[model samples]
Target: MTKTDRPDGEDSGHTGPELFEHANEEYDAGNYHRALELFDQAVKKGISNEVMYNNRGAALDAIGRGHEAVDSYLKSVSIAGRYELAWHNMANSLFSQEMYADAVGAYAKAAALNKERVENLSGLARAYLKVGKTGRAVAVIRKLDRFTDKDAAVLLMQCDLYIDAEELVLAEQCARKYLEKNPDDVEGFAHLGNVEHEMGVYGKAVDSYEKALQLTPDDKELWNNLGYTCFLAGFFDKAIGCFDKAILLDPLYKHAWYNKGYAYHGADMLERAVECYDHAVAIDHNDPVLWNNLGNALYNLGRYRDSIPKYVEALIVDPDYDIAWNNIGNALEKMDEYAEAIPYHDRSLEISPDFDYALFAKGVCKAETGDLEEGYNLVLESLDLNPSYDEAWGARAVLAERMGRLDEALLAVEESLAVNSEFDEGWTKRGEILLTMGNMEAAEASFQMALTCLESSHADTAGGLASVVRRGEVLIRLGRFEDALVNIETVVLAGRTNSRMILKDLELRRFMAKYELPKALVEIIRKIAEPGIIAECAEFMVDAGNVLEAERLLSVVRGIPTQSSKLTKAQARIMLAKGETDSALMLLNTSDGRSSDADLLVINAGAHEAGGDFSKAADLYSSALGMDPSNYAAAMGLARLMIRSKKADECISAADIAIGIDSREWEPHKLKAEAYELLNAPGMARFELAQAHSLLAGTGLRPEDIIGG
Candidate 1:
């Protein structure tokens, strides 16, 4: 054996060559510390040659002293610049220390020195990948393709680099190439699975991951990958099983727990998903994504209060988390704290300016706070970003209606219902706008549709109350007093918080038409104690032939401090209906009578007609019509008297005017039918009676009433 090959420390005066040989032997035996000592001793003895330096570098690298090894290899390369082994070894040490740029330069030099060295080419590719020069890595790998035996390890690394670059097609190619030679390579199949997943070919990814698990049944990482692949494929149950296996293999596998939580979430098992997320958070509490997902599950459960804290925790971990900011706003809005919710929406908008959800939410809050114009503009901007947002159209409908733009409101609500046909609120809003337009028949149909569309669970909602009030008012206008009372009483007894005029008007109309209201209806009115209610009830009792009860109710009304023109009109109507023509005439002869007050003129005309003064009644009706050309009540009154006076042609024209003004009233149709029968047009009379029959549905007034008139 050569003298330099002798065991280290065997001779006190050992030569540098003997010491270098002994260091090489120790390095081969895996005794890195002893080998480092021997190498240092040889280097200090002035025996530093290229081979000795390179050998010392290798021993230093084996001992995990990568930086010192890099220096030693640099010395070897400095002595002999063409030494490819030294350059390659230096590049590897730099790579181990994560000095990727330096490693790239060193590997390039080695590749130039020995083009036939596969290790040099492979190392150059690895260094290029580490430095993110994926194109250069790919080019260097192509050079190794000419070698007879495929470098499976290099190809696998190439797959990982391609994946990092998001070049799934190339990644899949590299992984398949590696697996072609090493068919049992578990990592190769796992890489292929990852490539397929990135390509969104989840079914293929699941197959690839399953193949990987077959080869490495005990690999926890493999099980996790398989589980994630299954999750992507929507096989949540299988994903949970794979994740469970991974957790079984390593109880502290936080990623497995996190992934299992997602699987449970996808399967709609929110409680189990929460349990898995809790376990994952316990293992790694600092992951913001985990907190965000936990909040999402809670939000899905309608636990807005519970979900708020979880979202706040996520924001604490990641202040710029736009989704968490949006979620916080959503939870607060759900709790009706719109003022507090707006700032979080603003934060989310600051992070993502084009966020449609944030824009819609902020707009709704503004509308709730009475900034209808500004709120409408914001909602328009949101719709500009996302034109398919159905709820934005509904918001626009409400804003437009509040602004008195009924045409615009109608169009917006129609568009909303077109997008979501089952939207009950949209239907109710459409009905309300129609009611305002004096389209009582259409309004009734729309309200009926809204009531039918309502979910049983939401029967007591604010929207439900609004729908009831709207439908009841429309029924009152159409003279369906019993139907109107049914709905109005239900709403009043359901806790009448809002003094909606429609509800009060509906109740007053019902009390004026019905001779006697049920105790429940009377109690509802007494509880509300609106002056309009008391006046209408007294008028109704007087008309029903109960003068004492009417006088008692009017005494109670006179005792109250609140006075209104509606009360005076009610008293005059009651007096006229009770045959007290002088009293009714006295009340109607107000200072406003000569000024063409249509209401006072109509009341005076009514008193004259009840007193059998047809000429005075006709002149008074003409005066009322002169003041308000479109007064349906005055035209209808004139039409009825004209029929009594045998003036069928004028009756027909006046009836037509009244019908044009308000077609839904069965009274106009009955008047027209009577005029048509007088003119001997029995077919037209039947048609008008049919219309009256349809409009006065459930009013106990049928086709016979119109025909008899």
Candidate 2:
């Protein structure tokens, strides 16, 4: 409310003074339009004082005529150049109009004239904040603190100023002080909640919001705040319930819908997440974050093709949305279109060069396409940008392992686990590296740790099933056939429609066949009836010396509709195992050329070696190694042929390569020992023989069986 001044001595006997007095009464009675008419009549009757003009401005401002109000204030100030009240009223008008710089000047003038007025100083501070002069705003707020009897609203204003300046401790103090003065003020409690949330004390923030809501339960904004705090505190169900309350209060609240979706996403209820996100997107179709979250839910559900279009819509809404571009690249990578994924990542980097997620994602795509060194370097850059990125470190470990830098890979994976000990994928990769290095006990421990983490973090998810399959692979290597069977059955039951899981189940079953397939296992395979699984089962039977059963399984699969490359390879392998080498070569020659598949090339090399063509066999092995340096069979096969040819140096080199591929295989160590013996290096031969004996310790291979007993 504006103060009304009595007229000076010159207007003492005029009708204008009486009219002005009546207008002031009308203003006091809150009839602002009536007051303005009376003031105009007074001015027409020749009352031209600063007080009359300032009163007129206040009436105009009260009637929502802001520009006219500012004009009247300026006239009052021009009449009496040092009128403090007129300056204050003008500053208020300017502030309302968002002319913050002009407001600051007027507020400063008013404050200069009356240093004790809280309104003048507070208005100046607010204007300074509007103009981003935070230091000046803080200075003004400190001056306000000098007054012991401050208004409660002023305290709340100071609290907001402190929060904007990131002085959270001071902000909390102010909020608490305001709440103490005005115990039932919802704004005070809301301010306290905001301060606590900024401090990351989410539980305290939730309590504050709950208290505020008790005062006004219908406040949808308060409900949303409480829900978000609960979400941050990891109370997903409670957060969802709060969001439901907010939605009930206001069905069109898009924020509540989005928050509910995010809570569902955290809980891994991805289908429910998609539902909430879809509702949010329908409410606000242009919100890029809602679209992006919808895409993420689809991607998590393994609907990569479906996810890509949602990300595209997000990009359409916000062309500079870097995360959406990165997500599209990720979906393509999931589809194994690595070459097609790189450009999307490139576009993301162009938009945000320092985005570490894009850098790491691009690095993975490069690694999948056979550029191990470039991939490793990109991962290093991502780590440099954000050293705490645990997944990037895991990627570095895998790339280093593929490049045969085993020691570096070990160090890299250790760093990854050190950063996040509960990272299941990191533990899984570490186990794989340890298995390759022949540290079987340590590898088993790592796999067990991985399973523990997966059980806690990813239980009942597709990711959890994948981790289980990896642990099953480790169990198979350790010769724990029954334990591996348990893992296989778990994945087979849970992920029956997943082709990758089916392939892993086939591999586990093949390894278990080394003993004897259980009745249950045979029944499970018979129920599957997949042609590829049947062909692989036939190959496994032939390897286990059950050639009759192998032939019978092969004949059954031949009647199936599919004629896959896997079936052809299995036929050629069975022929080679039966000593029909020429028939095996003819069968492979007639099949479609899959020369790029390292596994297929290794099989082809075996056929050539069985035909007694040592040179062609070595060539095929080299080609397979070129295709995939991690092909353990090709490395060992090349070393065996070199040993047979009496090329001791070449045999040692090839055996070293094979050992690098898989140090756990005792055959490579024995071949190295034989090579040393041929080279007349008796001491080295003894060392290599010791390695082979140690690696084969529990396998019934005596010291004499390894040579040099």
Candidate 3:
């Protein structure tokens, strides 16, 4: 919008020409108001020329009268349609007024008149960018680059334009060229850093940002950028230090606080991360990311109920925030409210159908609610969308296992571990599957691997305590009593209420007594006063041959003034262990008169068998099987009774049912061998015995132990 030169040799006979010349002088002296007054007077006196109007427009523009300046430039262009200066001035004026579309037309007209002018091309490129014509803007800048003689400003502008267009390689080229010409320019280094960051060359990004900081050490933005780059590069501690420096430079910098939270969260310092997020939200409550991050920190802390409000706050700020919706569902799912959590995930998927996390979450909820097939398909769909989603793979494995597709479950879990070798849950699931398949050595190795992963995670929270409990179960299974006790002690010391039930486990109690743990630790376990846990502890004591202690626990359970099938079962089991068959049957019959529970039926069948009522025992076992075909105890019990009665066909049928329930159990195969021997099928007997021996290989059981039983 610079003023054009005044027309030479003005009309000396007219006062208007003299006034126009004086206005140009005033404008040259930087007196825009006075120049505009004289120009208006000259225009009133009939001085209508392109140069006069263009110069007057510049004077108006200099005084912040953009609309008036545009009108003056239009007048100049209308008087002489070929005036490039007037067109360029009007384009600049229109750009200042945010009329980008109109500015593009004017700038294009100016460029058409003077193809060699850098100002016209630059203005046109900027207008194109403003109008979202990024490709056109790029083309214009490339043309401008040919004759700009490698201008530093033009190079920097081109770098920024390329970055806006997401042409990172070209952006990097322009930034590097700018730095080549302006070696110490902070902006040049910053642009290079941005380009490297977008390209995921984190090391180079860090170096460039560091150089920019050296040039402008007081720039908080440079420090923040360096911190985020380090965060993306997995340098959490270094990222935190950079964020600290940024906060020191500007105490109220919200992004610094937010970024510091992310660094802490990445490092698993969840409480500190929550503190930083609190500060961030206090500074800017409208920012959904801050609220969402606060929710995530709390969720990771096992404060699922507390996290819901934070996620709700994020939703309040941005109802369309799909991540927040999914997070809310995850929190509810953690609370075991799977049915309630499904609609939240559904809403998230509605908003963003390709949100794989939401799809997987909904799948988990469906599986928990007994829709195994539907859950499996949903998880498969999520895996199809994100092939590397390890959690989804793990969920699919669980569903496959539940559906009795054990081999498919094994392969799916292996796939999960393949994607993330350190996935502890995947290792844990692999161990459970292998144990079910009777591969004791491989199962132990898998559990050991799972423990290794959990130990390396360094997560000393509720989830960590749960992992410790899982490790304790593995240790107990592997007969590592000392290690199991150590894990139990860790959980007990953590004082998590959920550990109370785990402490009452039969094997865990045996380890506690065998290791002679302190009475204080014993007293900690005894503090569990819930009726259900007390009853379960009683049953555990009965199984451990501590009938007197079992009776004591049952008394406590019975005093709760509530009807409990568990209480009845525990009392009846204690009676049966004492050889009081009549008392056990009377208690079971009275307490579960009309109940059809398969486990209760199995217990009743055992009581009848102990009393030598083979007829009632066989009928009860058959009824239990009819109620639940997967009841291994009932199936084995029926098979043993059939063998005693010399009913080889019934024994083989019952043995087959037991085998169908769990192919890994050697007892069924051993019973089938005896059935075959009774029928004089020596070859079939040998084959069944071989299967039993194979299953019993590492179980410290000889062929006599299986055959004699």
Residue 138 lDDT in candidate 3: 84
Point to the candidate with the largest TM-score. 2
Worst lDDT 10-window in candidate 2: 700-709
Which of the two candidates, 1 or 3, achieves a greater TM-score against the reference?
3
Residue-level lDDT tens digits of model 1 in 247-348 = 999999999999998887776566677889889989987888899999877665446788888888888889999889988988887667888888999999
- Give me the runs in candidate 1 sitting further than 4 Å from their true place: 1-150, 380-709
The pairs that clash in candidate 2 are none
Q: Deviation in angstroms for 685 in model 1? A: 21
**All models, RMSD in angstroms:** 15.4, 11.2, 11.2
> Model 3: per-residue lDDT, tens digit, 1-709?
3354543333434478767877888888998988888887788788899998999999999999999899889999999999999999999999999999999999999999998888898889889989999889989888767764646777877777777777789889989988888899999999999999999999999999999999999999999999999999988778988999999999889999999998888766778888999989988999998899999888877777889999999999999999999999998998789999999999999999999999999999998998878889989989999989898889989899989999999999999999999987788788778766766668768877877776742226444555565566556545565776676566665555353434433344442355344556546546667777677767777766778877876676564676777788788889988988677767777773334477778887887887799999999999999999889989999998999899999999999999999887767777888999999998787667545544432232111111000
Q: Write the per-residue lDDT of candidate 2 for residues 358-432, one digit (tens) a residue.
A: 999999999899887788888999999998989899999989998999999999999999999988668867867
| TM-score for all models, in order of appearance | 0.47, 0.63, 0.62
Model 1: how far is 187 from its true place, Å? 0.8
Question: Candidate 1 clashing pairs?
Answer: 4-18
Ranking by TM-score: 2, 3, 1
